[model samples]
Target: MAARRKANRILAAVLVPLTLLTLAGMAMLWPSGSKDGISLANPYSAAPGVTFDTGKIQSVVEESCMQGSTAPGQSPDTGGQPAPAGSDCMFAFTEPDQGGSPVKVVVNPEVAQSHGVKPGDQIRYLNLSNAPGAAASQGSPAYIFVDFVRTLPIVILALLYALVVIAVARWRGLRALLGLVGAYFVLAGFMLPGLVEGKPPLLLALVGSTVIMIGVLYFAHGFSARTSTALLGTMFGLAITALLAAWATDAANLAGVGSHDATTLINTSANISISGVILCGLIISGLGVLNDVTITQSSAVWELYELAPGTSARKLFTSAMRIGRDHIASTVYTIAFAYAGAALPILIIVMLYDRPLGDTLTSAELSEEVIRTLVGSIGLVLAIPVTTLIAVLVVKATGVRTAGQSAVGVPDEDRRPHGTSGAGAINADDVDDTGALAAAAFERRSRQSTEGSADPATTRRGRRADRG
Candidate 1:
């Protein structure tokens, strides 16, 4: 019991100050929300006398490419070129959501050639019917396809995911989901804006991620020595990941080159550093996996100790690490495969280049993912043993008997042999603890009448009967 209190005090001393510092960092680095540096044009903003509207596809017709027809995302000044032999122009006849005549919407060439929409598909389009040039052209295009409406499908999947998680894990699962929402809130509210405002990327990521982990671990798992140990482990892993990412980003020259989005950000915002953004992304990407391994390892240690309280600390540590090893193996593959899946398109493109393996992996286009997998893997792998050790120490201090009595709360004599009596005799306190209750039950059975058991051999046989 004393040892448990000591551990709690130590954890409190460390975590409380860290939390305060993180809060201070967040306050200091909060974004001013000034849009002075962002010069990107908003394409979706409608012009005077024109509106963006949604519609259902009534039919699609193939025709020769028209020089004046506008395509989705195409600039108005540079119109479509003459149609190639195999690439005929396609247009969708859509019934607008607002009561009106069916409009002919020109589909973008990429979409028309790839996954063209059929009848009954809902899509958003630009309505240029009332624009200034509507009456000037011989046959002015009135509508242009924007993108598909995906709200219904996305919402359905989200609800189904929530139901399954809640049904399987109950209250804990619900808390986990809520914690996820809060984590995103922090990301969107604090970290993203801070980055845009040119805050120190490494510090912003570390502080923001730490704050997220603190909230997520405590809210989802509750306050306990076990949770505290896991949180500490998570912090260590996060720090390691940040440092590795910082070094890797610099050494590999990952300046977000060869990416269209990165180029766009560079062109639009002079304050935002593409490399810093990548650094932040590399660190943030590993948080989920890092937290998973730390918490799981911590829980594994506690459970192993509880199931066998008499096991030596060395044995306990060994057993817990066995579980950690399996986790490490599986989680490494998980990180690698997850990154691979997300970057599959890039992978296919790279493969077609027919470059050497070394050059291919080290290229700016692919090195970021390779480094991400390695850095995240290293951080999480190190955290497992650290979490296991902490959990083992804590569980030994609080969960098991120290000398002859319960370390949790019970008295010494309560654990004495079945028929013994002392100051620690079974009482209401015994009922409060599971281990104490089992001992008390055995004591009561021993005190019961010994009728029909005169022969010692016969009583021994009766005891062994259940073993068979």
Candidate 2:
């Protein structure tokens, strides 16, 4: 325990100062405004500039579906006329953002289910100087469908999610959400700008991720031995993840520029390394789940110790490993299934190919997913045991409870069956003589730390003193 405290003091003294310095440096170094603007790599035009305006639909002129050689019931060659009843619609709207002058636009009927715009609905649109028709170019204005201002639904959904989280997990959930906001700010404000300015993606991601993990672990769970243990494990996992991702990217010859967005980024900015950015993404992607599993494992070990405080460190380790095993079983599938779900469309397309299953899996896109999944899973799986081992050592070090409370992640309602809650409910045999076991374990650890066993007479004297 003394040794542990000394170590913590040293770490805090070093890390706290270092972190502050890093933040100060970041604030000074990061560019605020660039002439080019922020983008994936560089700004590439996905959509041409169109005049954006707001309006409310005043009258529903015509709503119909187009079919046959002509659109709806019109000919494009002779300037489109009114379409069928099932085709798109032409509407007159009051331009509130533009001096309230009434204007007209055509809304595609196909997007009705998705957009749900109707007469009297307020929306924003893009007014084109030259639409398809010569009439628009000549004199009339044409508006393109943009978006409905649905802030209420978005606000409601956000509130629902927040309520659900707070109701179930209470304070912890709130803190976790705060941590998420901090993570977002760091990624958006610091990491992204640095990446855009052509800083080393891997290094920036690594440092930013570390800062995020530190804040998230401590903020969400509070500063304690258990959180510290999990954090150490998380850092080690991140290092392993970064290294593996680097190796895999190189070995697999993954350029990470196959996607349309990546291709656009490459064309837009020739400076950014798509592959390096992908490697950085790979490192960042595993961080959340990696933190998740490590924290869980650390908490499980602490819970095991609290349940059977007298149990030997080895026994506690094995017990925690049992829980770790179950978590691993569920989580490995989580990573695999998550990637599979994301790539479902590609998987379906691949299935239509004339290739065998092995060949299909070995394709560029699919293989990238596989390698990413494997790398993340490897780091995650390894983190559990490391975290568990660390937790056991810390929790058992002085035979004293650090928090004097249940594990952080395991809620009070979940520690045992319903209507049962003390420290925990476990077989008495599992605990044995907790006092004796603690003393024995402490004695053994003390000898290991000092590199020598205590005298037999001193041990007997200590026990007698305790009895007295």
Candidate 3:
């Protein structure tokens, strides 16, 4: 026990420093860009053409007309010629298409002249339509449209998430953080890269998810029976979710849903598969529920064991299952509400269409969300039973009892020697009998010993000793 404790201390000392160093490294290597920005390697690199229906023309116009103007500023001409006054002022029109016609954009003469544009000068269009081109474009437009606005939130959210996790869970949170980092690396560095390189998307997602589960559960909870049970439950749940997602996606015949963005990707990268991307989404979506269910089930089992050490495996399972039942009920609602919250606008639009309720519910887009929620909920529900069963078996098989054997029903009498009565078990007569017998025996032995003594001095010394 002492040795094990010493080893644990040593391991903790080593791990603490290593973990700090790793976090420091992550801080140093963290991306400094914004979240909404485009990337050079993004598959959606092609520019999309703008098409407007008459019904949506007003919205298009409103979107395009929102612009800000800058005041004119004077600068020295490149040719050392006298520049016109107010030539540096600029006006921006937001509408790409004006009045149902392809709009002709003209930079103001004063602004153009100040920027060295002659009459009939054609300004090159910097296409910020997709990620790759947007990434290539440098300066204020790129910063405003892509980096500062687009990508900043992702970075900030990531940092905040890390801090919140660490604050809430402490050491386990740190381990979970490491596991999350590992999962991201596996997904982005391995799974994504492999899929981009033409690997199967479904296979990629499955393997990546498995790797993530193993790393996360073991690292955060350690390689114990409880962790193993949770991992098993989570993996099973993930598999169920993946299978269901695949079937639902095929049945619904879901085409790529990203509007112009998806079209841009299709045009830019023939190697990229939309089907694979869809599968990846399914795997990612189910992971949180899987983790939640497994962890909850494992906790329930252990808590049951702590509460009743000598509890039979069956009783423990029953007790734990009560908790699992509650978890399932709440989690099902949670999954539904979460997806519903995200798709509320879509649902509202469908409702406004005044189609039959059945037809609206069966719509492809709505059905996709429904399938996701149901499949994930089913996976979570199944995970509870698997985790509970595993935990019960593990606790029972290990025969490890918590402190205080009293709770486990080990009686005090069984712990004591036979014929040894407790304080309350002894009577006054028994004590008096024992005392009198001991005194009589001692007195007889003393008289015999004194009579057998040959010398008067010895007898006298014995008597004096006895008196004393």
Better of 1 and 3 by TM-score: 1
Q: Summing lDDT over every window of 10 consecutive residues in candidate 2, give the lowest-scoring window.
A: 64-73
lDDT of each: 0.82, 0.69, 0.58
lDDT of 3 by residue, 147-203 (tens): 112245678998899899899998999998888889888677666665555466666
Question: Residue 222 deviation, candidate 1, in Å?
Answer: 0.9
Give, for candidate 1, the lowest lDDT window spanning 10 residues.
Answer: 428-437
Order the candidate numbers by lDDT, best to worst: 1, 2, 3
Candidate 3: residue 226 lDDT (0-100):
64
In terms of lDDT, the best-performing candidate is 1
lDDT per residue, candidate 1, 281-313, as tens digits?
A: 999999999999999998887765554344557
| Evaluation by TM-score, superior candidate among 1 and 2 | 1
- Winner on lDDT between 1 and 2 is 1
Q: In model 2, which runs have C-alpha deviations exceeding 4 angstroms?
A: 1-50, 55-104, 107-123, 129-141, 147-150, 400-468
What's model 2's lDDT at 46? 23
